[model samples]
Target: MAGNFKMLAKTFYGFEPILAKELRDLGAGHVKEGVRNVTFEGDTGFMYKANLCLRTALKIFKPIATFKVLNEKELYQNVNRINWPKYFDCGKTFAIDTTMHSDVFNNSLFVSQKVKDALVDKFRAVERQRPNVNTHDPDVRINVHLYKNFCSVSLDSSGSSLHQRGYRIATNIAPINEVLAAGLLLSSGWDGETDFMDPMCGSGTFLIEAGMIACNIPANINRENYAFMHWNDYDDELHNKIVDASLNKTREFHYKIIGYDKAPSAVRKAQENVDNANLSEYISIERKDFFRTEKPIDAKLHMVFNPPYGERLQIDVEDFYSKIGDTLKQQYPDTNAWLITSNLEALKYVGLRPSRKIKTYNGKLESRLVKYEMYAGSKKAKFNPDGQEAKS
Candidate 1:
């Protein structure tokens, strides 16, 4: 049955295009990018594939209904009008999460409460049984998005964020989100053909994701559960088939992935995470200060890392960044280094002109993913401190 339905994949800012491209590649139809979200059409199997393969998506939402509501009363009525029994049984536990961008709705909690009441009433009115609300770990999670007078009700297919790929159990003070790290690496055109390094690898997230991307491994291969698995319409056989098919597409990677951290604790944590991801064969971690180390590989090296931004790690911001610049300029030749940091003022101390800078966010702090390319050989790399190219 080719039942076409709309689904929205939510992602961090600056990742909608990547998410949309992922959906398109995964056999989705009518792929369209929106603000921090990508909407697409796919059948049930395709939905499972998207939840498993997408590297940048945080959540995949299957919107069951959309309507216009001027006030809470209308919202309650419309929520009750939905065929809730079609999605789940009354014995299952569910949760309602609400987001509002309307002036009329002052409280999202209130909206969620109303929607829950509507659902409970609908189920109880017919079968004399109602689904209990379990906020922490629900069998089914529902999303209600209200933009002005419009409301879209969706069922979350990806549970607890796809960033929780069920591999990383250890982390440092400022561990990067797995999805964000993967997206940043993809944005930098990492195909895993060359040697990859994360000089400040906190917990080896980039290394693991890079290995997965190189080997064509599904992003959520290690994940044990998703919200869709608990739905009444979930097809276990279809999901297993999708998993096997995706596994069949796995390819071999030839290059090495390495991680370096000055802190011994960070190194240990990274190694533990790498082992958990079962990527120890492709990745190596060392407890060495990036500033004191030279480029390990003579060939073109691709580096992506989230260095200390002074806020998380207690290090001198200006001097630390200056050391980073000195290390890269003196020791790291024939390399392209990419790093994300929230400290704009500290970035100036690096004294090297970033050839490329993309605006991104690390949580609430606005940051930039900057790139410095050191040409391989006697050709000296150019550094424009002002970010403008200087005439020869």
Candidate 2:
């Protein structure tokens, strides 16, 4: 515990608990959930493990400095006082991202510029050179958080957002975010016990994530890089050992994971992405219309998917939703179907009452993740007010 330090794992809204549970399960100390982030204590090895194993985390940050600042001058002085050379060398390029929730700083971009100037000035004064700023792709990324009169500076351990798992080489027009997909699966209580499916599996994001969750595979097993690798104190041998240990802990999953997409191009892309993730054996993608298909398995099925919200994919909103309800009620019984949709007005057209409705956001669009439970037998299945099996 001597080398352990506090770290924050940022996530999407409603995912704090999931991320906290993941950290605690991975042996993190002092785990606490806050809004869209979770803070915990871990050593360097654990940090590596967190980056590799956290399915719901968007990014991981190691806070290096926290101080009080009243104005831009104090911010510049405090930021410049830190030993910038200790983190990374002048040869490495760096970028600063600032987020401010304060009355003092009106523009976050200005704060970022000031922080960047301070860091560059410090490096120039000491080493006679400064790291270049690369906003697009930086070797090192620093995060600045300002609230009221306090500032928190952190070093980003995960470079590109962890959602970019590096396995999704091919994506459809509206592929679901990997973190969101995993969170939805976890929220649905999907522990790989029953058969899993995504009827509208655009790029197989849900199928692949479900497979990983089932098999206890590290979420970023296919990811090849992290910002920590470029840090000054990074230990390659330790990182490799951590990776090996995580890989060795992967358990075997023996349930079927299937995906279906009506479009041939989506089917091809989903298969390609699944293959890229090395999970083709666990997941199978078929080019078939979900409305025309019955349950692929006779046993209980757990379904999670992101159907078109009528924005990207054009369709008759009410008719499509009604078809979804009809298909599940009449054809695909014994299934717990969960879907996220931004079209709240259209959700009423689904006919079946949702057992659960959770508030969530999908890229600025406030959405609801709803669940419809279909019983095994026709007599047992719940029907709408119309008293019809498959209502129009």
Candidate 3:
């Protein structure tokens, strides 16, 4: 059994608090949040569990070494000192990735090359052979982070991004990233207590992620592989136990999760993804323009989705957003509607003052997750009847 060690879970911008909370809830000790990341103390089993269950983390890194270095030669010497053979053998295909914020290193690619040379040299000297470099798909991934004069090396526990939850077989145009979808849902305070919806659900990512959250399903239940499985200290039995334990924690969801898409192709893709996730029992998809469809149920509804950003879709940005506001105001009452969009210029046309405007990102586009509280009657949108944003 491995002793407890400090690890970092990297997340998207503005999700550091969410990831930190998730880590703490999952029994991580000494949890602390950083910029787009959270550091915590956990043992090997906890590592497996974090990778298996965390919905917002893009990757989990187990730091092995930290060194002070001012020059490339020092960097090489420090990287060569690590006992690489104890982590992974020379036969394992590996890749070195670098991230830095330092005047000492200007080119990250060059830094990666230098680190790779040092690692390969160490292996060759010890075993008379070296691992092959596999950039596309590697059995082992080593990360080097340089901040100022300090360089930290870590082993990427999650092979691919945890967002690749292995259930999305089909994707519509501009399908939201799975991790982002889950984070947005969680940030919206979605707990599966009431009916849920994604009116413009693209490929059903929100629906599936919402279902998983509602039922307490592990976010990566369908994922079959991780980078930790290839390490020399991989423990299959412990990993199996972790998976089983997580599965046992899933609770039954009594509410409904519905998705609506106007496009037939998107509807098919969302259905395919839902089936792949084995969540068809909890989620249903329909083909209908959201502006034309009313709320699916008469209960309190929780809604989250990413609409066409006008970046890719050739729609009237103002009219589309206005229609969204109109639908929420007229069609969906007693609903908490949240949508993420990068078109800040167009968001003004919604004519409704969002109660909460959280800063987030959709890929490279800086976006906002705005919330529209549609009460049953007079407490609805803040839009004036003559189509003007009401004074706060």
Please provide, for model 1 over 218-313, each residue's C-alpha lDDT reduced to its tens digit, 9 standing for 90 to 100: 999999999999888899999999999999999988888989988899899989988998899999999998988998987889999898888968
Superposed model 3: Cα runs more than 4 Å off: 378-392
Task: Candidate 1: count the clashes.
Answer: 0
Residue-wise lDDT of candidate 2 within 1-392, one digit each (tens)? 23999999999999898889999899999999998999999999999999999999999999999999899999999999989999999989899998889868889999999999999999999999999999999999999999988999999999999998988988899989999999989988899999999999998999999999999999999999899999999999999999999999998888899999999999999999999999988899999999999887789999998988999989899999999998898888789999999999989999999999998889899999999998777524457778765623
Candidate 2 backbone collisions, by pair: none
At residue 277, candidate 2 shows an lDDT of 92
C-alpha lDDT score of every prediction, in listed order? 0.90, 0.92, 0.93
What range of 10 consecutive residues in model 2 has the weakest lDDT sum? Answer: 376-385
Count of residue pairs whose backbone atoms collide, per candidate: 0, 0, 0
As for model 2, its CA RMSD to the true structure in angstroms is 3.4
Q: Indicate the worst ten consecutive residues by lDDT in candidate 3.
A: 375-384
Q: TM-scores for all candidates?
A: 0.95, 0.96, 0.95
Cα deviation of 377, candidate 1, in Å: 1.7
Off by over 4 Å in 1: 378-392
Error of 3 at 167 (Å): 0.5
How are the candidates ranked when ordered by lDDT, highest leading? 3, 2, 1
